[model samples]
Target chain A: AQSVTQLDSQVPVFEEAPVELRCNYSSSVSVYLFWYVQYPNQGLQLLLKYLSGSTLVESINGFEAEFNKSQTSFHLRKPSVHISDTAEYFCAVSERNFNKFYFGSGTKLNVKP
Target chain B: DAGITQSPRHKVTETGTPVTLRCHQTENHRYMYWYRQDPGHGLRLIHYSYGVKDTDKGEVSDGYSVSRSKTEDFLLTLESATSSQTSVYFCAIRVLAGGLNTGELFFGEGSRLTVL
Candidate 1:
């Protein structure tokens, strides 16, 4: 079974400041990585994903993640954050088959103005 | 939007009561999944259905059961609800495009259940 570990439970940052949410996974086989964001009182939405190709994957909202095979980590980062980016972000991992996904404890990104 | 809907957006029930949550999708996706979200536990899968009448257990399936009779409907049931079962439940459908699994999931708004 694959397990995901998110190092930070809460991250507080000022608006326009850079932020990073760490995520690590344990799996023996090749896997896919994903980041999902949940706004207050809303369900989660796919932020971005890493299937193959380049190790660095990016989302339209200025957030990106790098898949480091050696570290077994896929950490999400944004050069600058907005108040709207304040949400709970979850990191998930699934095998190549995409049969099931394992998620981490999640990190609450609090962007303060 | 993937057109996923979960019933009873919010419910308050007592322990030992039977609870059923329904998930409906308009897209006729082949796969549907149930997950529970907690404060520090993130989201844990309870069950998943690949096709009609073909379901499988997930990591936290000890006290949960699921049934899928139609491609658009997936149901999660708790035979006897417990206080520990009080959590927000989400239903998701796998994104399949061009007959390929996209490795992306579309989630529902979630059903908040509180067992007191």
Candidate 2:
């Protein structure tokens, strides 16, 4: 079985400041990781994913996450965040087969001005 | 976009009343899933359908049922709604374009159900 854990429930950062959301997972087999963001009153959207190769993966919107195998972590980071980045972020994990995903509790990121 | 839509974007019902949510997709994807979102719990899968008439229970399948009679339509039903069941529900489809297994998923706008 696979499970994800998001260390933070909420993170408040000033606009243009760097932010990091920690995520850890437990799985016996190789896994695929993903980060999703949900805006107010909307469904989740894929922010980035790590299927294979290159431990680092990035999204189009300046968000990136690195897959650390030894630590079993896939933490999301952004050098600079904007007010528009305020949203709930979720971390998910699945086996290499990608049959289903196990998600974390979620972390609410509030980028203030 | 995947052209996925959920019906009854918002609904209010009483306890013990039966509620059904519909998910429709135009892309004719092979997999459809139903998930519920709560404050602390990110998203918990309720039920999923692999094909027409082929449905399976997810982590939180109790008190929930699903039906899929067509390729593009999946319906989730609550036998008897409860207060705990009041949450936002989302629908997702797995994309397998051109025989490539990208493991990408597209989500619907979501349906908010309030059980009192």
Candidate 3:
């Protein structure tokens, strides 16, 4: 079984500041990684995914995550963040050709003005 | 949008009472899942279904049961609701493109259940 670990429980950052949310997963032979975000009272939304890619994947909203095979990490980062970026972020992993995903506890990103 | 909807968006039930939550999808996805969200425990899978009449337990399936009798509907039941079961429940459908599972999940708005 695949498992994900998000060491940080909460992250606070000032607006326009860079931020990074760390995530690491149990190494697997065929891993597919994903990042999902949930705003207050909203359902989870896909931020980005890494599936047999160039090791780096990006979201339209300027969030990016790099799949580090050796380190077993897929840390999410944004060069600069807005107050709207405050949300709960989840890191998930699943095996190729499988639909079951193992999600990390989650990291709450709190962006302040 | 995957056209997913969860019934009883908010409900208040008593302990030991039976509670059922329904998830319906118009996308005809082959996979559906039930998850519960708590303050520190992110989202934990309770149950999932791969096809009609097929279901499986998840990480937190101890007190939950699920059934998928049709392609578009998946039901999750708490045989005997407990205070510990008071949480936000989410239903998700898997999107498999070209027969490849990218692990993309689309979630419903969520059903909030409070047990006293």
**Candidate DockQ scores, in order:** 0.90, 0.80, 0.81
lDDT assessment of candidate 2? 0.93
lDDT of 3 by residue, B1-116 (tens): 99999999999999999999999999889999999999878888999999999998899999898889899999999999999999999999999789776679999999999999
Total clashes in model 1, counting residue pairs 3 or more apart in sequence or in different chains: 0
**Candidate 2's residue-wise lDDT over A1-113, tens digit each?**
78899989999999999999999999999999999998998888889999989999999999999999999999999999999999999999978876787889999999999
- Tens digits of per-residue lDDT, candidate 2, B1-116, equal 89999999999999999999999999889889999998888888888888999998889999999999999999999989999999999999988968987777789999999999
Identify the runs in model 3 with alpha carbons over 4 angstroms from their true place.
B98-100
Give the alpha carbon lDDT tens digit for every residue of A26-57 in model 3.
96577889999999888999999998859889
lDDT of 3 at A107: 97
**Whole-model lDDT per candidate:** 0.96, 0.93, 0.92
For candidate 3 chain B, the 10 contiguous residues with the lowest summed lDDT are: B95-104
Name the TM-score of candidate 2: 0.98
The top-ranked prediction according to lDDT is: 1
DockQ of 1: 0.90
Cand. 1: chain B TM-score: 0.98
The CA lDDT at B32 in model 3 is 95
- The i-RMS of candidate 1 is 0.5
